[model samples]
Each structure stands twice: as structure tokens, then as C-alpha cells.
Target: MFDGVHLGHQSIISKLNAISKGKDLESAILTFWPHPRKVFSPSDDLKLLNTIEEKKYLLEKNDLQHLFLKEFDEDFRNLTGEEFVKQVLVNKLKVQHLIIGYDHTFGKNKSGDFSLLKKLGPECGFEVEQVEAVNYKDLNISSTQIRNALSSGEIISANEMLGYNYSITGKVVHGKKIGRTIGYPTANIEVDAIKLLPKKGAYIVDVFVNNTPYKGMLSIGTNPTVEGKLITTEVYILDFNDDIYGEEISVNFRDFLHEEIKFESLEKLIDQLDLDKKRTDEYLF
Candidate 1:
């Protein structure tokens, strides 16, 4: 799905670009949307690294010349390996060359692989190639692994695999006005429902408002110290005091700070907040 477009996906795209340039052919990617798993098993709590819109934005940064998003419906799912090759690759796209990952599979029940592609490529008047997996620190890089890292608040590891800092854009909304009382006003962000969030904790992040970046601290959790129930994503922009209740902002995670903890008293929570601010300032500076 190219969920995160991590190093592995980038490696394959690099190979595709190199070969396409050498052969004077167009480099393209054919990805399915709505995720086949989501269609097949609706009950699965499948958290993705990027939404479809985010995926498109990320892929555009690469050397890809073309991108085709096919809906993963029952009709597309029922196509056999050969049928897909003839209908989609040969007839519709007129694909001259196809590049895939080491373990890529397609068609009905994932019956198509490198071997199947090679077998049909000759008859279909096309070429097929597969790129080996990318590795980091002797471990294979994958979207699932990156998601796992993010789920556990391993920001550094996830960012290393992603080749960029993990970020999310959301609109500022109203909160209970509690932080301001402690001299640390926060912007409560309303994120997309489908966007996968990192583990519940405080993080040192770079906040972008109106495309301008600023250092900030983000908290993602149910505010137990405030006796709050709903999980909220809030950020306190350092040295920023603006009435931006409806403004859109982006938060780029830098590192995990600490887990959310319920303090004994509001005074204790303020002390911890001060410490968090000091640590965040030190790291950011």
C-alpha cells in the first residue's frame, strides 16, 4: 500500500526510476485503494501510517512519473492473475515494463508474483523486474515495522525508517482552557478520524502554522490529570501566543519525551510541565 513510503518503498522506486531512465520508459506505480484487507475483513482494526491523501502527497516527492489508484472492490478482487495482467497491465495501461518489490503479489488472493509476471510479460509484450528489500541495521524495513515503532512511541526509530519526521496536520479547536491557568496554553488539534496516531505520550515536535515552523511540545492522551475522558492531541507552541482556534497546523514529531501520567495535584502537574518545557527547550535549542 506504500502506507508510509518508507525506505523500502523508496529503494524500489529508486530502482524503477533508474531502469526507466536507462530504457527511456515512463516510471509508474499501480496501487490499490481502500486497502484489500479493509475490503475483505471489515472488522480488522487496521491502522495505516498514511491516509490516501497523505500517500499521494508523499509519493509525489519521489521520482514517480505516473500513479494509478485502483479501487479494491469485489470485481477487481475477483480477477485472476492472468486476467489482471491482460486487462489492467496490457490493455488499459499499455505498460511496457513493470517493477515490483521482492515480495509483491497481486490479483485474486495474491496469486500473482514475480514468477507469474515473468511468465505473462513475454506474451503480454512487457518486461517484469523485482527489487530486493531495503535493510537498516541488518533489519528489513517495512511499513508494518514503522507502524509498530510509532505505536510504541519510538519516534527516533520510526523516523529513521521513514526517511523523514512523522507528521500530521490538524485544525486547532477549543479545549477546557486549563493549560492557560498554568501559564502553558495549548492548541487542541482535531485530527482526521482515519489518521493513525502515535502512542499516548508527550513529544517534542516542530509545529507549522501557516507553513511557518516553530518548536513545540505535543501531548496525545486522555487528560487524566484534568479528569478528562476524550483522548486529545494538543500542542503548546513555544513562545507563540495567538488566537488560532480554527487555524490548520502541522506537527512533526522529533522525539518521545515521556508517558502521560496523572499527578497527585494540579501543582505537581504544573511542576512536571515546567520540567517538560525545560527539557523540550534544551533539546530543541
Candidate 2:
């Protein structure tokens, strides 16, 4: 899967699992790394729903027997539709049956399709099956849709499509210590460069530290109130305080609180934060 591996992907994978079980075959996912988009446009600002590690973890949870991760580069991108099937699917994987998404395409110049796979399946000694798209709110569920929802600050809709809460995993970093002065200490998060972030705003989130969940208010934006231009993500965990710098954590976006605003003063910012905390408490509890 390219990104989120949302419900549509899960449907295909679930079909693969059922088919594999019925036919006494092993199931595996053949996914590419470095994303094809990143390969074609090296400098493009491409963000992904899940990092490689995150994708691996999710796939493992689905009880996949094997994960065939291929590094995508210039050479890999040049392979023809036939070469990919012959060299990779048939020879390497010995795949007896292939389950693909309805709109799935592969090979050089995106030439491969379900029809090509079906035509070649008999010759290659394999079966080809395609899973129909899953729809939510009359819209086809896709990584792009989820990404767009998140970019627009529609966390609830994004989570609904994902079949899980949208989250970001990162390491806690040091910040300018501004929140502390305002009586709300925060943990600055340093996330993966390629990881897709939700819209810049404040959110009601659940912070996962050492496998424990803590309610928190997350901020994602430039500190306009402080006249700072650098975009930062920080979380103020409620009812908890301890040094956690350098520790890895994950923040699950539960609800959108409000947009980032430039308060007139620090006092105004604190006052807004108090309201934010109250809203978060009401939502969480």
C-alpha cells in the first residue's frame, strides 16, 4: 500500500487472507518503498500517511505472513509489466494468486492493470482477483481523501475513513520554553520529515508515552503570538509533568479544538488555553 492502508486496502488484504486460507497458500504484501511519487519528483513536497516503520507495524498486526518490501529507484521504475510479473511475482514470490485493488496499477509508465494481470495469470500459473473500492459518506475511501480531510482539519471524517484515529509518531524535542512561562509546559514533537501532518491548528489529542495514554492539547503551527515563524508541534499533557525529552511518542488526534490564532498578549493566550483545556476535558471524559 502507498499510504494510509485505509479501509479499502484493508478490504483487499482481508480478501487475500480469506483466499489464502481457503486455498492453502501463504499471503504476502508486495509494497514499494521510497514511494513512487518521491522517485518521480525527488524534490516535491510529498507527505505520507504512514512512515515505513508505521506501515510495517500495521501490516504485522493484520497477521501477514511475509512483507516483500522493494526499494523503488530509477532501475526498478524501468521494469515493464511483463518483467515485473515474471521476475518478481512469478519467480521470486511464486505467487499462486494475486489480490489487487480495483484501481491498482504498476510497472513502468503505469502500464499494468487488472486486465493485463488476468491475461497473464493463466500463462504465469496464477490467479488474479480485484477488490472493489469501499465507500464512506458516498465518497470512495482513499489515502488521498484521508489526507485531504486531515489537511483541512476534519479529523473526525479522516478517522471515520481510516477506521482508526489519525496519529503521528515522533520524538520529543526541546522548545523555547514559552509554554512553561504561561503555566502550561509542553513537549515539542519532532516528526518524520515525510510524514503528513494535519492542518495547522489546536487539537484535542491523546498522547501515548511508554504505552500509557494521556489527554493533551496539541498545537501545530508557527508561534504567531510570539512572533516566531518556525512551524512547531507541541503538546500540553493534562495532569502530568515529567521530563520526557528524546523519548519517542505518538499523538492520536481525537478532535479539532480550534484554529491557530495570534492572541493579543500572553494573558489572552493563557485564557484561550484554559478554555481549550476545558473543552478537551469535556470531550475526553
Candidate 3:
């Protein structure tokens, strides 16, 4: 899974688990890191739905027997379909059965599809199975669809496809402390550079501090009202007051509240914040 372990990926994993049980075999996943895209297009601003840490957590939660993470680079990418299966899947992994997503492809030029795999399975002494696409409201659930929904601020649809809230983990960092001046102290979050941020807007989120959850409102954007120059992710936790700087926290995006707005003055900004808090309270209750 490149990004979020959305429902579509879960479907494939679930099948792997089920088939493993039926055959009394171990289930394992062979995933590539430093995504192939990053290797091919080094300069592109490639953001991901889940960090490597998050992906590990999600996969482990699925109870897979083993995880084989391999680095993806020019050398690895150059391997042909036959070589990949013979050397990696057969000799290295000793995989007796391989369950792949319906659209899954691999090896150089993506020449390894179901047909290619099936043709080689007999020679390789393995079985191949493909899990059909999982659908949500007639739309096929996929990472691309989830990413599109998130980038467009459609959190509800995205979460529906994910089977969980879209979340980001970051560390609390220092800010200008302007929110404190406005009676709404905020926590400025510094997330991974490669993490995909949702649309620049206001959102209702659940803040997890040391694994405990709290309600919060998050704003992601450049502070246009304050003439700020850099993009920031900030959150105001309701009824919370603590020194959490340097602490790692996770924010689960629950709902899209509104777009970031530029106010005429600090007073106007405070007023909108009050309204946002009110809406957040109503929604949470």
C-alpha cells in the first residue's frame, strides 16, 4: 500500500489471511519502500496518505505473519517480471501462495499481472489468487479516490472509503503564540515533510496525546489573515491547557468544517474562531 491502508488494500490482506488459514500457511506482505515514484521523479512533491510508521502500525494490526519491506531503487526497478518472481518471491520469500489485488502489477514496466503470474505459478510451484475490488457506494475504493477526496476536503467520503478517519501524526512545535493573545491558545504541529496534507481549511479533528483522545478544531493553511508566509497546521483543543511541546501527537480528521478565511482584523478572526468552536461542540455532542 502506497498511502492509506484503505478498504481496498484491507480486502487483499483479508484474503491473504483467510487463504493462509485454509492452507495452514503463513501470510506475508512484500512491499517496497522509497516508493518507485520517488525514484523515477525525484523532484516531484509526492505526499503520502500514511507515513511508513503508520503503514507498519496498520499492517501489524491486521495480524499478518510477516512483513518484507524492500527498498525500491533503480536497481530493484530494473528487475524483470520473471527474475522478480524467481529470485525474490520463490527463492527468498519461499511463498507458496500469493494473493494480490485485482489490479496489482509489478516488476519492470509492470509486466507482472495476473496472467503473467498464473503462467509462472506452475513453473515456480506456487498458487496465485486475485481479490476483487472492494466497492463503496458503487465506486471502487482505491488510494487514488481517497487522495482525491482528501485533497478536495471531502473528509466524509474519504473516511468512508478508509473504514477509519484520515489521520496525521506530528510533533507539537512553537508558533507565534498569537492564538494565546486571542484567548485561543493553539498547538502548532510539525508533520513529516512527505505526508500528504488535506486541503487547506478548517476541520473537526480528534487529537490524541499520549494515546488519550480530545476534541479539537484544526486549521491547515498559511495564515493569510496575519500576513503569514509559511503554511502551518495548527489545532485548538477544547478545554485543554498543557505544555505539550516536543510531544508527538496524532490528529484524526473527522469532518470538514470550512475553508480557511482571511479576516479583516484580529477581532474578526476571534469571532470566527468562537463560531468554529461552537460548531465543533455541536458536532461532537
List, residue by residue over 1-285, the lDDT tens digit for candidate 2. Answer: 548878998998899889989999998999989988888988989899999998988877887898889999898899988889999999999999999888988899888889989999999999999999899999999999999999999999999999889899899999999999989999999999989999999999999999999999999999899998999999999998889999999999999999999999999999999999999988843
Give lDDT tens digits, candidate 3, residues 180-251.
998999999999998889999999999999998998999999989999889999999998998999999999
lDDT (0-100) at residue 247 of candidate 2?
98
What local lDDT does model 3 show for residue 54? 89
Q: In candidate 2, residue 176 scores what lDDT?
A: 96
lDDT of 3 at 103: 86
Sort by TM-score, best first: what order? 2, 3, 1
Q: Against the hidden reference, what TM-scores do the models get?
A: 0.97, 0.98, 0.98
Off by over 4 Å in 1: none
- Clash list (residue pairs), candidate 3: none
For residue 53, give model 3's deviation from the true position in Å: 0.6
Score residue 209 of candidate 2 by CA lDDT: 94
In model 2, residue pairs whose N, Cα or C atoms come closer than 3 Å (at least 3 residues apart or on different chains), thus clashing, are none
In candidate 1, residue 28 scores what lDDT?
88
Candidate 1, residue 181: the lDDT equals 90
Between candidates 1 and 2, the lDDT winner:
2
